[model samples]
Each structure stands twice: as C-alpha cells, then as structure tokens.
Target: MKFDPNSNLVYSTDTGRISPSQVEKVIPEGDGIIRIHKESKGRKGKGVSVIKGLALDEKNLKTLAQKLKKQCGCGGTVKDFNIEIQTDNRELLKSLLEKLNYTVKLAGG
Candidate 1:
C-alpha cells in the first residue's frame, strides 16, 4: 500500500485507495447489516461459512485476503467481487479490517 501524505489517503499498490466507493456490501431481501453471512457454493450446494463482509474488486479484495490468509495460516483469494478464504476465521478478519474503518456484518450463518 502507498500512502500519499499530501492527501492523507492510504493507497494500495493494487487498488490505489481504500475509499467508500471502493467497498460495497449488498443486502439481500429482508437483510440488514447484522444479517450478513459468508456464502460458499461448491459443486454441491451453497453453504454458509464464517464471513463478515465482502469488498468489491480484485485489487482491494486480494490485498485484504492476503493479509487474512497469512494471519489464519490458510489460503484465500479474490474472485469476481468476492473474497474467499479456506479457513473459518471471520472474527479475526473482522477485527483486523475494523482497524481500517471497514464495516463488518455476520449474515446467513
């Protein structure tokens, strides 16, 4: 990540900046912030995992996913507009991101 002191904005080497316009969480019908959940759709069916929230792009998502993957000692990646992890450590990830002012919600599960 790159920090432009003049603008007081922290920039990512990939996503450039962590701005509100860069992150988005879609709420399904009858869902609110706390209703968020992690979703996994394998070859079988969709299962709810431990996901706090989601980011919108590969650049920002990859950076965040990498950090979580490292901390959790697992593998994770960014695909489409979703950040997917191989472990079930959403609580840890939530705390880490909260330090960066990212909002988190537990949905579905």
Candidate 2:
C-alpha cells in the first residue's frame, strides 16, 4: 500500500495496454455460416436486423456490411464480428448473402 520508487518492480502489468491479451486474427472457415435475426428490445420496438456468425476478417466484414446496407436501401454498421442493418428485412439479406456463397440461417422469434 506504499509507493516504493527504489524497488525495481511493476505494480500493474497492464497499466497502459490497449488489449489485455493479444488477439490472433481469425481464418475464416469454409462457406461460413451466417445467422440473421431481428432485435427490438433495446431500440424501443424499432427492430433492427442483426447478422451474426460470419467467419470473415474485419476488412471483408466492413465491406460486406456496406454492400448490404446499400442493397437494402438502409443504414447499418459492423461491430465485434457482427453486422447490424437498420431494418427487419431478413429475407432480402438472406438471399443476398446466399448469392455470395455463404450459408445463411434465420434465428429469433
């Protein structure tokens, strides 16, 4: 509980690190499976279509999100390995993804 400047020791190992541990880049698996769903709980009943389980790197994911947003004529964003489109158009997204050769699944009540 006392500061010891003379001691050659570190009080905290992660004082100024961005990430606690190194995150290895993921290699996307074959014909990655993508799951889409509609979520409205946190958005005050304005449901947004959430796409998950896409085995793509960050760059590719971002590009895909942009394309999908344009095709759907809506706005969207990519975050934490998932894409969220600002609409409840699951079928349109599913078909678009399938055309890109990715296996797609719909989830949520």
Candidate 3:
C-alpha cells in the first residue's frame, strides 16, 4: 500500500484503490474483571485497591485511573497495582473501564 504525501488515503498495488470498511470484530477471552480495592496499612504504609491479575509492572491501571479522574472530575492516584479515585463512584468507574476494554467488579473491600 502507498499513500500520497499530502493525502490521507492509500492505494494498493493490485487492488488500485481501497475503500474503508466499518467492520467490527468481536474479541474473546476478555472476561477478566477489575476489582476495586480498599486502602490498607501494610508494612510500607497505606495501600489501596487496584485491578488484580494484571502484569506487575504494567501502567495500564495507572492510565485508566488517571483517565477516570478526569472524566469524573475527581482526584485520584495509581499505586500498588491499582488506581484509587477519590470518589466511590463504582458505577461510573465500571462504565468507563468497560469503554477502555476492561471488565470491572467490586472486590467488597
């Protein structure tokens, strides 16, 4: 495929021009849920609930938390493998995370 320098469309060598298709693909095996955690005093200090079963060093949780804070107009931070928002807005968090391709659940902490 090749595109003109100033244009946003592209062309294929064999197909000539390609038309954009609005196809939606369904993804499986994405049923993992995010758990909302409560703050606790651990050996280090105050710890909070965050999404579980994710990579130990990944920053997706932090990014999700930050985005939610902005959307909810609340203050929050990401730490200890989780994102802690200032408000206990579970429903809002769920919807927001789902939009970001996460399955969410309350951990009951």
What would the per-residue lDDT of candidate 1 be over residues 64-87, giving only the tens digit for each residue?
Answer: 778877877887666555566675
Clash pairs for candidate 2:
none
TM-score of 1: 0.52
Give per-model TM-scores.
Answer: 0.52, 0.74, 0.52
* Candidate 3 wrong stretches, greater than 4 Å: 1-31, 38-59
Give one digit per residue, the lDDT tens place, for model 3 in 32-61: 666665555452554444445434243555
lDDT of 2 by residue, 1-109 (tens): 8976875453346664344244456655645568898898988888899999887888989999999999999999987788999988899999999999888999895
Q: Residue 41 of model 2: what lDDT?
A: 90
Please report, as a residue range, the 10-residue window in candidate 3 with the lowest summed lDDT. Answer: 22-31
Pairs in clash, predicted candidate 1: 35-107, 36-106, 36-107, 37-107
Better of 1 and 2 by TM-score: 2
Index of the highest-TM-score prediction = 2
Evaluate model 3: give its lDDT: 0.61
Candidate 2 residue runs with Cα over 4 Å from true position: 1-31
Once fitted onto the true fold, the runs of candidate 1 whose alpha carbons sit more than 4 angstroms away are 1-36, 40-56
User: Which has the greatest lDDT?
Assistant: 2
